[model samples]
Each structure stands twice: as structure tokens, then as C-alpha cells.
Target: MAPAIRVEIEKKHIDEAIERARTGVSKEESYYYGDRLTSGLQLRVQGRQAFWALKYYNFTKTIGYAYPAEDKHLPSVSAARKLAAACKDILDDDPKMLEPMLVKYYGGADRDVKKAKKEMVAVSTGWTVEETAEAMIAARTKPDTDDPIKKSTVAQFRLTLRRPQVKALSKKPIADVTKADLDAVKREMEKSPEGASMIKKFVSDIRSILTWGATHATDMTSLDPSNIWWELVKSGKKKRAITRSPIVDDIVKTLILAESYLERPLPGRFSEGKFGVGHNVLNALWWLALSAQRTTAGTRLRLVDFFPDPKRLGSGWYLAFWAEGETKNGKAFVLPVPPRAAGFLQERMAKAKRNGDSQWCFPSSQARGKIEIDIPVDRNSPGGVTERMAVRDYPTKDKIAKELAKNAKWESPYVDLLAENDIMYWSPHDVRRTIVEVLEEHGIPGGASAVLAHEVRLTDDLLFVDNARNREQYLELRVSRVTKLAYGAGGFIPLKSKAMEVWTNTLIDRYEELHSTYRQARKKAQAERVLKAIYSDANSAAEAKEAAYLELPKIRRKLEDNLTGHKQMLSGLLKKTPPPDAGVRTARIEIELAQADLDAFNTDPASYAIEPSRRAASRTHSAVLQSALKTDEKPVDLVVEAPAYTQLRDQFIADKIDVHTFRLLITERYPITLDMMDDRIITGMVTGDEAL
Candidate 1:
């Protein structure tokens, strides 16, 4: 091989030459030209061959590279020189370029070094990338300490938001809420005035929640401050407007109207036992209003709550106990029961006991096992019983009070019953107020606060002394007085004794007639049942007899036919001859006998032992028709007539029966009047008729 060309060039000189070439200067004027000339002369091994070839290659590739002018010798020479120059540049930049050649010399071998290193690291540390990420997040966001917001306050806030009306309104985004929306909700509440207070509370609660969220929510930055609940509250306050209370008279009248509508039937008064717009609920509401307690509490009163002692000192009645949980203050408050209250409780209790509800005096029809009565007995008392009694159970006090607030006669019931009834905002609390007013009127100083369960201190003042003694003395005197006024001497015969007697006699007579009619009906039903049983037994026996008779004939005919076939078969076989188609003939005779039997059965099925079914069917149809007709008759007519007679008899006995009593009795039971009864006598006879 020709001696390889060698050129010594400094690193700086090569960099200078490359820069000059990049700048478009002629290579001959650069540092590389002088170095190339000196090296070419000293190393004469390749002489002008390397110099001319490299120079020509560099010249052609300066602007753009090209193959040598197609001449065979020059082209090969130029290609070799170019290859050598590229190798030199690579060797100069990286000494490791010689590693592959060294590996080739050493007989190239495979190794697991890289993979082993990775596995070693992985085994040493078990944590994955995801576990690390999760740990980091936990460290950043977790609460730092235990003393956070109180759970009870949070629960209250949640409950406040959970009201039905609040929940419905809160479904929208908090930001979009407006006063118009609140007004709309208020308007909806107007439809149920009884629920207005609850609605107001609910609105206030929602505003609080919004304000809390705006101030403390972690994501509050995304919320607009203007849309916050606090903003709504402030805006509302700025645009304050007065709202008028509904006319109490109109509301009371509406309640009365509802009662008039409910005079049809008990179920008619309320659909699904829910106090719809009706009299029963309204009446309960009136009681609540008069009692000066929540409507729900009054309406849900239980017989057990009233400890009526006919011999008690005050009002001949005593509401000695009430449940702690049921009171507004959530503490058991003793009531100085009045005679009127005691009478009402006793009457209700008797009625409930008669109806098989002695355990629950005011049990709801829908809720079973929710018996309300559970009176705490004073174990230390002289004659107290330790065991709590469940004389009657009623709904929770809150529920009863709520229902009463919406009652129909809330306004007029007291006005009509008592004179000088100038009062506003009449409610169950007003009943307590009335008691207080009456006590004060009678010069009983502390009577107002004590009987009303109001917080008051008993000092040495005259008023205080009066308050201390008046409740007890006044209650005793009033009980006797009212008792005499209502039921006369002995407190047994009602003041309306004559009227009650007449009503009772009439009722007894009518009831006797009804009992007679019912007995007759029952006897008729028993006779029909007995007749049906006898007929059924007879029909069964007749069917069995017919079946036995028909079965015997069928068996006899089959036996006779079989015997004749056997005789023919035996004759042919005894003759030891192929008796001319004897087997076939026997078969034909058997088939013909069977056909005849079938034809007889088909022509008259009764002959085949089927029992006649018409008699039983006819009897059943007749019984059903008779029972239906009896049911269709007017059953209510007798019941209706009986109540009037009872009222008339009661009126006669009490000597206080009047048109109002008659009207009430008729409205409650008969709901109709006879033309013969005089309006004036009936009107005069009733005690509360004029008052109502």
C-alpha cells in the first residue's frame, strides 16, 4: 500500500481553519494551508498524492461537495482521502471510538450488568412512585390539630338547613339566590299560616349557612361575594318592608266554615287522617288556642295528663302532671287543673276506654305501638303508686300544638263561651293567659304567674303573698262554684239534668228498638245458614247413592260381556281347530258391547252416576241474593234516628235541653230534625246554645 499521508495540526489551528472555512475564506490563506504544506514536504511518504487529493476534495466540498470528474483513477483516490478525513475527525472528538475495535479484538461478549444494577436498586427500596405521591398529599392537606369546629353546632346548622321548605329552596346554586326567590318562598308559606313561623326560622337558617360558606369554605375563592348569603341578608335589610298579620277573625271563621263542611263524616273531615281543611282539626286548634299552649300540645292531649280528682280543692279538677319532654321548657310543669278540664278529660277517657284503647287514650290510627300515656307517679306521695300508668297516649306535644294553631275555632270559641273576651293573638298560650287574668280579677296576686307557670319570685310583698296563697284557695273555691254552676249540688247531676234525662231515655228506647231489629236480622241469618248446611249434607248423600247405583250397572255389564267372550273362546280352543276367525269375532263382539255402553252413557249422563248440581247452585244463588238485598237496605237510617231519641231523652233528664243541644245532637248524629219539635223550647233548653 502507498505510504499513508500524515499531517500534524494543533487543536487551535484546526479550530481557526474551520472558522475561516465557515466564513467563506479560501483555505490556502488559512492556518490549515501552511500546516498542510510543511507536513506534506517533511512526510514525503505520500508526497503530492495526499496534498493534491485532499486539496481538490476540500475545494469541491467548500460550498457543496461533488464526486471527482468521472475519471476512474482520480475518483477512487478522492473517495479514500475523504473517508480518512472523516475517521480522523471522529477519533479526535472521542477516544472511545477505539472501544468497538478493542471489543472485536477481545471476542465480543454479552453481560447482564445494566439490568442487574437496576434490579438491585429496586429490591433495596420497595416503595413505588404512586405510594410516594399519596404520602406527599396526606402530609399537605390533613388537619393539624384535634380542636376543630364543635360537632353539636355543626349538627344544628345541618338540621336548620334540612327543613322541607329550606331543602327545596337550597337545591339551587348559592350564588344565584336572590330576594325574589325568598319572597316567592314566603308567598308559598302564606298558603299555610300555621307554618309561617317555621318557614321564617328556616329562612334565617339558610341565610346563616350561606354566610358561613362564604366566609369559611375552602373553595370560597371560586364563589362571588355578591352572591353570598350575607349579601342577600344585607340587601334584604336595606329593602325592609312590613308584613301584616292575618285577620284573626277571618281565620277563625274559615276554621268554622271548615267544621261545617266536615259535618258529613269523620273520614270526610280529613283525608288520610291528615288535618285537611276541616272541622275536627280546627276544633283541636281551637282547644290549643284556648289553652294558651301550642296547637300540637292541645290537640295531642292524653287522658293520663289530666289527673282529675272530683274532690280536689281547686276547680274540682287537677292537671297534676305532664311529661318533661312535652313541655315548651322541656321540664315537667304541674298544672292546677280546673273542673272543666277534668270533666273534659274524664269524658274523653271513658270514651277511649270503651273503644278498647284504655292503654292509649289518644292513639293515632296510623301509628301502632306508639302509645303515648306514661305518667310519672310521685313515689313519695302518701297514696302515690310507683308504677307509671299508660292510661292514654297521644302524639308529641309539638305536633299537637302545631295542628291546634291551625284550628278553625281558635278565635271565636272563647269569645262565644266567655264574655269580655277582648283579646288579640289568641293561641293555646291564651288559655293560660285567661286563667291568669281571671285569677288577678279575683284579687289572687301570684295566681297569674304561678298557675301560668311563669317565672316569678315570692317575696314578702302583698302581691307575692297573694300569689302564693291565691292559686290554692282560688282553685278550691272556683272548682266548687263552677261545679255548682255546671252540675248543681252534689256535683253529680249536671246543670242540664232535665235535658240529659230526656235525651238518655229517648236514646235507650231507640237503642232497644235497634237491638230488636238487629236480633231479628241475626236470627234470619242463622236460620239461612242452618238450612244451607242441611241442604249441602243431603245433596252429598244423594250424590254418593247415585254414584254407587250407576257403578254397579257398569260392572255387571262388563262382567257379562267378558263371560260370553270366554265361552266362545273356550269352544274354539276345545275343538282343536282353527275356528273360522274366532279370535276376531270375539274381539268384534267385545268392541260392540263397549260401544253400546258408551252410547248409553253419552245419551244420558245421569245414568252414568253424575250427581245433579242444579239444586246446590240454585241454593247458593238464592242465599247470596238474600244477603245482598239485606246489605243494600238502609242501615244508617236506624242509627241516625237513635241518636235524636237519645238526645231528646238526655235533654228531658237534664232540664237544660235547647235548640242548640238539638242542633248539636242532630249535627253530630242524626244531622236532621223532626218538624214537630218547637224551635223556641229546644233553643231555651240548651245551656251553651246562646253562648255559641
Candidate 2:
């Protein structure tokens, strides 16, 4: 081989160099002449062939051919020097980018240059963006780094790639991803859901995968470095606000509505050990509202992650929790659980324990199938969740209010209730933001960063300015050692506790007000108005009183018809098994209310009546409707917990309106007997216009 030599890389010098390479070079690879204009630039010649080369960071790369006789597409002397100078600057920052640059601009037209890399996967036959992204995901599965990408981050990465514009472009290999294609993808993502605020983060994630691929040539050898990714990697960071700050009162009301939904009996179908994850969903929603943590923090939280802090502050023993090794900043989160929240924590602990789910604080409530064989037999056996909440049995807020309504087909109260609270829409993440904002307002400026599990000193350099790094002088501008020590576990507790207490108390006050409103509304309900006239009014028309009393049984019969089909279906289920625990509790209430409705029908309108509790009377409407839909298989000897309205029945029964045996006869779950009805009342019912 000819020896390397220095020369001005002009067209004249390049021509003279190739002629000498033909005579002096032996049967070897090549000979080179160095450039004075560019640091790593060289003109390499091998007999009849000559090309521009660069040796950046010790690795020699063929820039392109310089021999006109060999190839007409040769770059000019000045153009080759310009390309070399630009590439050398990029290499100074990241030397790993050299292989990708060659794959992109080899021969001045992105084709293989076997002189630099051992092999290359060209854009035409190589892995698409999707395929390379998958490779990146796999490599990160057990990544060997202090800070690794999270599974959720990978999930978002895949979702961004699936967007229409991005997905279409991803079908092409990374090397073929042009600037036009990337710009179009950027616009599409910016207009997407959560776009304006999250677009930068999404684009950065894509660039990360490309960087991973470019560095690891054995896995992915080819990609167009000229694509817009390099420009975007260090681009401007101006995050736009997408979600508005949550209205603090609306947050409180949302919690109130969620509690109200949970308090009601589960709708009939969901009540039984119906195969579902409903209870977990409802409980999870409440927990999320109270805690104000990320959805995953609450959803994936295990009972084990929360150990009570031994340092009990006042009467409350606060819990210190971390995000199960998945905090966004990779820092441990230590927030104080206020007194109200601690009470809620205890309540949830008791509930989870009752269901035999000690592991997950929010466990799946899925029940084994109570549904039986199609052959003629009772399909349902005694029903309840057979599996306890355990490891990885996380919670979600889907279908939260579906099982709360008496009528399952009706639109879930969850949606309408949120609307009533004047929250057209809000998410768990919105709640998280509101909590953070509250902390910021109450605490010192930038003091709330610790609540979000961020390192205050690292993320927010309070004492330092941006230009301070460019003009360094002093040892440091930071705070004292005592201040740093104070910023640890003990310092944050007071700030966290105050924020939590204010929010929790606000929510509790709102909830109590809502209950007061409910009481006022129930007093004026239509059923309440009719009952007062039928039993209490002293000087009403006899015909109006008889007519009002007559309407009760008619409403019962209509609702009872609605229950028939469900009862028949339920009987078939019970022949083999029993109802689910929730279904059983609710069904028992329905049966008692239906029996009470029968007793009210059989009683004669008294000359002097005792006033009944309006609350119990109003509850009767839902109970009657619920009972009609219950199954017929009865447990004769078993005494289940009774409904609230049963007290109203007891009030009338104690009045001795009829004989004790007479009361027992009418209340039994048998076909309604007309034997006790007065002839005049019966005739009045036969024809409403006729006299009582």
C-alpha cells in the first residue's frame, strides 16, 4: 500500500494523488492524502478508484468517490470539505452517530459504503420504525442502567407510534424517514389528544429509540441521521398547558358523589356474585379521589407498600408511600396522610380484610361463574368472590356507578353526577394536578416539589441562575448544610400534612351538605306527598282518600309484573346454587318491602292515624321496585338483615289496625288474597268513578 501523505484537498491535488496511487500502491486496500481545510478529511485512492474519506474519532469512514473517470457523481473539493467539517462537529458531541451518518449520506446518496461498516441494513430491506421500536423495547426489558424506562413509558411509546400519521410513516424503515415525513408526523401528534402539552415528550421518546438503535449497530445498523430527529433532540422546550387547574370545590363534590354511589345497594344483576370486577372499580375511584396520587400509584398500590410511620404526629399515624419502584423521577415519595385520610385508610383496610384480600389494597372483585348448565335446574349456587385480592390484582375506575342504580339499563349515575357537580369532564390525573397546586399554594415557593417525588435541589435550582454555569466563579451558590438536612423526611411532613388536611376537611364538609340536601329533597318527593294525604289529612273527600289508597296496590301490581320474569329466571339459577352475597342482601330488602306494600294494601284507612317517618316511607319506592326483580328461591329459616323501611311497617303494625294473625296472613309472600278488602273499596277499584 502507498503511504499516507498531506496535501491541500483541491481538485488539482486530488487528481495528482490518484495517478501516483496507481503506480506506487501495491496490491492492497488503498492509499490516502490528508486535507488541510478539514481536520479528518482525506482523499483515498485505489488504482482507478478514488474517494473522499474522513477519520473522525479514530474510525475512518468513506465520504464518497472523488474519481470522475470511475463515477460521474463525485463531490467537488469544496463540497466534500464542507460535509466533512459539519460531520466532524456532530461527531464531537456523539461519536456513535458516525455509522448512521454514513448509512444516510454515503456516496452523497445514502447507499452502502462497505469500507466503513462491516455490513449495513439498507432502508429498502431493513427493519421499519415499528420493528426497531420493538427491538428497543426488548433491550429495555432488563436494561443495565441506573435509570431504566418504565413499562408504562414503553406503552405510551407504542401508542404514539400507532397514531395515524406516525403509524403510516413507521411502516417505512428508519433510514427512509425523510424530513417531510417527520414534520407531518409532528403536526399530527401536536393535534392529537393531550397533544399540545405532551407532543415534545412523545417526539423525544421516538428520538430515544432511534438513538438506541444508532448506538447499537449490531441490532440496527441503518437510519437517516439527516432526518429532523437530530434538530428536535436539542430543540426548544415550551410546554403548553392542556388541562386547566381543577376547581377545588368540584374536587370535593366529586368525592361526595362517589361516596353516595358507593353507599347505595349494588344494582340487582351486579349484586349477586355476578362475574365482575365492579366493587374494585368503585372503591378504586374513591381511593383515587382521597389520595390524589397518579392513577398507577393508586391502581397498582399493594398493602405491603404502605408501612405506618413509627413517628406518630399528633393522633394521626401518617403513611409514607413510594411508587412501587416506578416513580417518574426515580425518587422515593414521602407524603403525610392526614387524620381524615388515615380514617379512610382504616375503613378501606377493614373492607379489604373482610373480602379475604389482604395483599392488594384494591383487589379484583371478579367472582367465579354462578351461572349454571342450560339443563333444567337452578343455575346459581351461594355466590361471592372466591379469589382474594392478591399480588398484581390492581384496581381501575371503569364502570364505577353502573351497579349503583336500581335500574341497570338506565345511564349510570356516575356521568350525570359529575355533570351535576359542574365538572363537564375531569380525570384522575387532573385531580393529581390539583393536589400539587394546592401544595404549592400552601407551602413555600417551589417547596412542593418533594410532594411529587422530585428532588427539589436537582429539579429546581433555587439559588442558581442559568448564566451562572457559563460564568463560574464561586465554590457554590447553594444553601447551608443545616438547610439541606432540614429538607429531608421531617421538613416535608408539615407541608404535606397541612395540604392534605385542608383538602380532606373541604371534602368532608361538602359531603355532609349533600346529605342534608338529600333529606330536604326526600321530604318533598311525590310519594311522600301522596302518603300524607292518604293517612293524615283530617278533612279530605272520602272518594279522594279511597282513590289515593287504591292507587298503592295498582302501582304494586305494575311493578310486580316487572319482577315476574326476573324471579322465574332467578329460580332456575337458585335450583343449583344461591344468589351472590350482594344480590342476596338486596333481594332480601326487596322481599321485605314487597311484603310491607301488601300489609299497607290490606289495612283499612283509620279514622285517626298516627304519623309515619317520612324517610322510611320515601325509601319504600326503591325497595318495592327492587323486590319485584328478585328471584323466588327463599331460605325459610334464615333471617337476613332487613331494610330501613321495615321500621315504617312496624309503626303501623304496632297501631293494631288489624289483628296480629290478620297482619301475618297478608304479609306472607303468597298470591294476593282479596278476602280482606271491603266490598265498597273493591267496587271502587273495579270502577274508579263508582262510590266507595
Candidate 3:
């Protein structure tokens, strides 16, 4: 068939083989050349062609034709030898390089040439951080991919680098990006705990961009942020570079005011009408505080996720909530909400029943009134109005963020109400933090974390029982304690459950005192301003009468003191005859003068009525002034009066009146005059001591 000649291919042999191969071949024959230790190149001959080939270790390739054909496209003997030498050089440089080097030398026939050329171009060109980031974003967000990136992830990446300080570095060449640039980003956000958390994310996003670019676009210089793990010195102490929860009491106070604002919304500036959104926000705040759920988990709650306790007879004493695909850890969790939160949930259910039963508990107004797409329709109708297609929409982190921002907007209708009540602003996460702290302070360390975990276990298997009912009961007991302590609502269990009772009472007391003090301060400020206005306006005669109306109490006290002193002197008048008569006459004359002055003051304003009445036009001012003052007092009473007992009875029946609500009512009734609402009074009104 063919010659089985094995020899080291030399220059002369290649020349002779090429000349013979141009004629034709009977079968395939090969002559190998180069070092045996490193493997060899082959000059193979078959039917009408001879080509150069290689087999070195794992690498095998057919480089090119060895001899010229009709088209004379094949390499000459010397050229083939040069190619073999080039392949040998590439392999000598790197054993892995045979495919790519062969592709480079041979051109169009090889698929790897395109890859090689692209790699060369990438290595040669310098890519800026901005350019590489855009490329990375595009690649991640490509359409019709098996695993598309999350929209939130894309937005986060865009936002992280868009900050003014970090944005400047985007124009820097990737190769020139040093750890210093990363450190600069950290420095900008390191001082603020919230900002520190963002910095960590920003660094993570940047590193991801650099890593992606290293493989896809350019060889990025190593920028591992881990290498720059320097401690953030704050107040000379090494600060823990992470976001921390806010103080528990601050959150509690703010939530109390938030609750009040929800009830009586302030006048609107930006939005008009009722404050349904405020109700949603208030519920979200309580839910997060009681459940210690992440914002996403809580906001994404659906009506279907709730499982009411059979034992509670659907009073929502123990409710289990589980939202799929909406957890920080990415696992579905069955969270047991405490009694207070359950009460809130029960109210929400009633509200939803009245409001068309929206699918989500905190549903977006945008998606609340949608129609299902699967509804049967007349296909042949010439013209018909069809309902908008319904889609399952869950509240996302972005949506919740926008809602919170809207609530806190300066132009928000309710902002003035919060401000007037001395309520401060706080993020939703702060509630979770506050819950954690309250739990820890009252002997449930890591209790809040268990609230967020899929399994409800913390330092014991109380919640890990094999029986579902026992597990639920344990979860309820655990969650109930924390909620009762933080919210000061739900039927109080017992003080014997650790220090929950004392801790809860202390927190509630602190919140009440703070709220009362702020109210008193506001009242004092208002009083001072009113008095100042009265004194300033006393320049006119008619205004002086109004001023006298305000000064009525001081004037009456002075007149009573003078009459009492005059009567005391009558005891000594009986001792002497002339003295008694003289004393009696003197007393009569003094009384007459006082009566005369009082009569003049009560009549029309005279020019010489009294020293203080110099500005009074006439005595008739007193009559009008007294009526105006009484009218003002009536409005004050109307403003400060508690809701009627009928309303209180309705609220109590609805399970809407909490300890805070009761305290607020009492405060409204007496304001700064009362020390505190008596617990006995509250007990009589609310029934069991557990409620207090």
C-alpha cells in the first residue's frame, strides 16, 4: 500500500519527498523529525497530498500542506521546515501553545486563529474601568440567557460606582487601578456605619467588575480589597466596619409617634386625601419589629402565606408566615408572629376584606386592581373593552425603598404631623435592630436572629421538635415574649418569663416620659408665644381690655388678699371705743373706694379707670373680652378632649387600643397636669391585668 519508512526528516529528505509527492501517492506515509524526548513533527504523504503535522505529548495538529499543488497554495520544503521549527519554538516556549501557535502560522483553516487574534488585541488594548464596567453589565444583562442576572443586581452595580467619589475612578485605566483607589472609596464611607456597609458592597461590585474584565476584556491589575484590610479608627478605637442597629428606645419612640400619625394624619402638602399609605407603613413597621424579618421578607408578605392558629380560634393569637423566594438567606421560612403582630394582621385582614381582598398584605397600588389574563373573552368581538391583564406582583426592595422615601418626603402630607409630635425618622432595618437589642437585654441573646432564620432555634431545640404543633407553640412562645417586650401590646404573659416584664415596663415608661416631655415643651412654647402676643398688643385701648381678660386671675388674687387683711384688723377694733368706730369707718371708706373703682372698671372704659386701664377705651371692653376668652377656652377643651367613650369602646372591641393608645387618651384629657394614667383605671377599662 505505502512505504513504511521511519527516519529523522532532514532538509534533503523533505526536498525529495515534496518533489515525489507532487506526482501522487499510493497510500499514507509519514517521516518524523525533531527531538524524540520532546516528541516530533511529521511530514505525511497520501494519495494526492503531503502535509506537515505534529504530535507532542497531549498536543496534536495538522499544520499545513507540505508540498505545492495545482493552485500552488501549499508550503515549500523550506517553508514547511520553517513551520516545523516555529511549532517547535512555540512548544519549547510552552507545551500548551501548539494549537494556538499552529493557528497563528496556518491562518484561515484553523478556528483557534480568531481566538488567538482576539486575545492579542485584548492584551494590547488598555480598557478604562468605565468601559469594562459597561461591558460587564451588558454581558450580565444579555437577553434570552439561561440564567439571567437579577435586575436589582444590575441596578446595584450601576449605583455603586456612580457615587461622585467612586465615579471618578471609572475613567481610570483598569491596569492603573491600584489598591489605593479602592482604599479611597473605603475612606469616603468608612466613618458612617450605614455608609460603611455600602462601601463593602461597592468594593465587592468593583472587584467583580475587575475580575470579569480580567477574563473578558483586558488583563486587569490585581485589586483584591482584602489586601487593604485596614482598621477604621473611630474616636481612637478600632471601629467595627459594619452597619449596626440603632438604639432600641429611639426606635420605639419613633414608632410610637408613627403610630399616632397614622391615626390622625397631619395636613397634606404633597398628597391629598386619606393616608392609606401611612397605615400600610405603620403595619410594616410593627411587623418588622415583632417578627424581626428582613424588609424584603416582610414587604413581600402575601395573604396566602398566613396560616392562622386553630388553637387561637382564628383570633390570630398565633399566626405562621412563610414567603417563598423572598429571604436574605434564600430559603423559605415559617415565621411565627407574636400576638401583637397577629392582632395587627387580623385588623389588616378586615381592612383587606373591605378593600377588595388584595393578594399581597402590603400590595402596591399599582398592582392592586388588576384583572387576570386567563379570563375567558369573546374572540370574535368587533370592538370590546377588556380588563387590563393581571400579573402576580410582589413588593421588591426597590419598591419598599421608594415607599419609605415617599413617606419621609418633605412635601409629604404627614411630615408636619410627625414633626409637631417630636417623632424622629428611622429606617425599617432599625426596627429589626431594636428588636434584637431588646431581646438581648431581656435575656434572649440572638433571639432576633432566630426570627429571621428558616428554623426557629436559638441555644435550644424548643423550636426544633419533631411534632409540628409543639414546634409552632414553641415558636409562638418565643416570638410572643419579644413582641410583648418591644411593642408593649398582646396579652401580657408573665413576669416570670425572664426579665421581660420589667424590661418591657421600663421601655414603655421611657417612651411615655419622652413623649410627655416633648408635648409639655411644645405647650410651654405655645403659651409663651401667646402671652408675648398679648403684652405686645396691649398698646391699644381695646387690646388692653383683652389683656385684662388674660390678667383676670392675678387681679382677683390681689383683691381677695386685700379684703382678708382688712377683715383681720376688725378683731383689734373692738378693744377701743373711738378706735372701733374709727376703724369701722376707715374699713367702710376703703371698701367704698374699692367698690367704686370696680364699678367704673366694669362699666364703660373711663379715662381715669385705673393705672393698668390707661389703654382701655371703655369699660364695655371687659364684657366682650370675657366672652372672647371663654370662647377660646372652649376651643382648647375641644382640641384636647379624648375621643368619646363610644369610640373608645369600639376601638377596645376591635383590639386596636394598645397601652400607648390608652396612655395618649389619658394625656389628652389632662395634658401636663397628670402624673401618669393610673394602672387601676386602665385595668378597669381594659379588663385583665395581662392587657396592662
Against the true structure, what is every candidate's RMSD? Answer: 32.5, 28.2, 29.2
Candidate 2, 385: how far from true, in Å? 21
Alpha-carbon shift of residue 170 in model 3 (angstroms) = 36
Q: After superposition, how far is residue 670 of candidate 1 from its true place, in Å?
A: 31
> Residues 1-692, candidate 1, lDDT per residue (tens digit)?
33333555344433443344344433243222222433221111111121222333123212111122222121222333433354344345543342332223223233222332222211112222222222323432346522234344445545545555555555554544557767666666556655556455556655655554454442532334455644444212232243323233422332333344333422222332343223223334433433434433444454444444454445464543334455556543344444544454444334431223323334433333422432211111101000001101122234435555677233211112111222122323334444444445446535445433522221211111123446577445533443332233322232222222232233223333345454465554443333332223222333343434446566557656665666676566556665557665765676577666656655654433322222333333454334424555432221133333433433422334544564455434322222224331121122221211
Q: List per-prediction Cα lDDT, in the order shown.
A: 0.37, 0.50, 0.49
Q: lDDT tens digits, residues 93-207, model 3?
A: 7655555455444454543433444443122136778878887888878764333476778898888778776877887777666677777767876666577557767767787
**TM-score ranking, high to low:** 2, 3, 1
Candidate 2 per-residue lDDT over residues 166-217, each given as its tens digit: 7687787766665566666677766667665456765676777677767664
Please identify model 3 stretches exceeding 4 Å from their true place.
1-244, 260-268, 271-277, 311-316, 348-354, 368-425, 456-692
Best by lDDT: 2
Which residue pairs does candidate 3 place in steric collision? Answer: 541-615, 603-619, 604-619, 605-618, 605-619
When 1 and 2 are scored with TM-score, the better candidate is 2
Pick out the ten consecutive residues of candidate 1 with the lowest summed lDDT: 382-391
lDDT of 3: 0.49
